[model samples]
Target: MSNLTRTQEKELKEAFDIFDRDHSGSISARELKAVFKNLEISASDQDIKNAMKQMDINNDGEISFSEFSRVMEAQFYRKYTHEEIRAAFDHFDKDKSGYISADELRMTLSKMGKTFRKDEVDKMIKSIDKDGDGRISINEFMDLLN
Candidate 1:
């Protein structure tokens, strides 16, 4: 099972609640269709049914919190293509240094309007910096994403 951080879990729960209309504590097919419609994604009845079947771990024809969290968590950590990883790495390496320093990460997050403390940024860098080089190389970033 995927272990989600508290923040992630909260976000996922919020999303699930948005989709679970009627205060049913579960996502019905009609509610799922409404969600797709709100997202402007075209989904047929069969498509919705198939998705419900895949996410309804207990085969109950609906998605409970546990099932919704599991499916959403898997989607959250889905692998990225090499090109996507390279593009992200390029965006983070503002100095063109081929490696992302903790300061760069902080600045990037700031630009995106997401703030983190120095220790949090350091922890993030440490998690992705496989070489313990105090920075994130392209390879290290790719490995972390994949």
Candidate 2:
């Protein structure tokens, strides 16, 4: 959380608030499950239990914003090798171009069994496409994944 920019922290806070549906300050397992359902993320009972167990650092059967943000920061510091990251970017950059176009992103996701509409694909690209390039540069892609 300390390393996150203000905007990033704000976004995380918003996500946490989404899970904290009861205005309860903390997110109970039931609240998290409802949020997951609302997002159409098909998390299983075991998945929810495991997630709750992992994030409830205080063993309180709930996740505080601190706990949730800590887990998010841990994920931000993921352990992928540099080569692995490059390979992933390459996989998405289908034409071997230096940047990833919206079509390439959509096709790559589709090939990997992910189905996103055109607007969805565009939105994903827009989020990572810094410099108003309308495409994802390798640096931007690396910044996002690594």
Query: What is the TM-score of each predicted model, taking all chains together?
Result: 0.54, 0.55
lDDT tens string, model 1, 1-146?
Answer: 65888888997887787787677999999999976775455899999999999999998888999999877898668888999899888878989999999999998766543568999999999988888989999999888778
Which candidate leads in lDDT? Answer: 1
The candidate that achieves the highest TM-score relative to the unseen native structure: 2
Model 2 lDDT per residue over 10-54, tens place? 978877876777879999999888766754468999999999999
List all candidate RMSDs to the true structure.
7.8, 6.9
Worst 10-residue lDDT window for candidate 2 reads 106-115
**What range of 10 consecutive residues in model 1 has the weakest lDDT sum?**
107-116
Screening candidate 1 with a backbone cut-off below 3 angstroms (N, C-alpha, C), the clashing residue pairs are none
Cα deviation at 71, candidate 2, in Å, is: 0.9
